[model samples]
Target: MLRLYESSGRKISARIALGWEPSEVFECNLLEEDRCPVSIQGNEINAAFGAYEIKSYYLRK
Candidate 1:
């Protein structure tokens, strides 16, 4: 599963195993570094492509 941490170490973000795995990390996404989980935040997970921000209040999928 992918562990999304905030820029600062003061807080942790999310654990995503969102039922999708690719061949490589660089070919997938910046946030998509490891294996995705089978259970994310359902519909509350938000993702930004280029920017490093996941979210201030919610964990991403």
Candidate 2:
């Protein structure tokens, strides 16, 4: 699980390195009740967070 938080109202780029490749990746919605598929490249995950937004991702191997 990866959680990202931004206090300021600014867009930010995030890169997370996973030691091992994951078979699947899911992006959790604000409520964390819904999930959607996310693309993964190499051994890392790249994402952009909007202003004053919080994002969470779940990786499954």
Best by lDDT: 2
Question: Residue 18 lDDT in model 1?
Answer: 40
Candidate 2's residue-wise lDDT over 2-59, tens digit each? 7878888999888888999999999997667688998899788988989988888888
Model 1 per-residue lDDT tens digits across residues 12-31: 44443445433332222355
Instruction: Show where candidate 2 strays beyond 4 Å.
Output: none
Which stretches in model 1 have alpha-carbon errors above 4 Å?
A: 1-10, 27-52, 55-61
For residue 35, model 1's alpha carbon misses the true position, in angstroms, by 17
- The lDDT for every candidate, in the order shown, is 0.37, 0.86
Task: Report residue 60 deviation for candidate 1 (angstroms).
Answer: 18
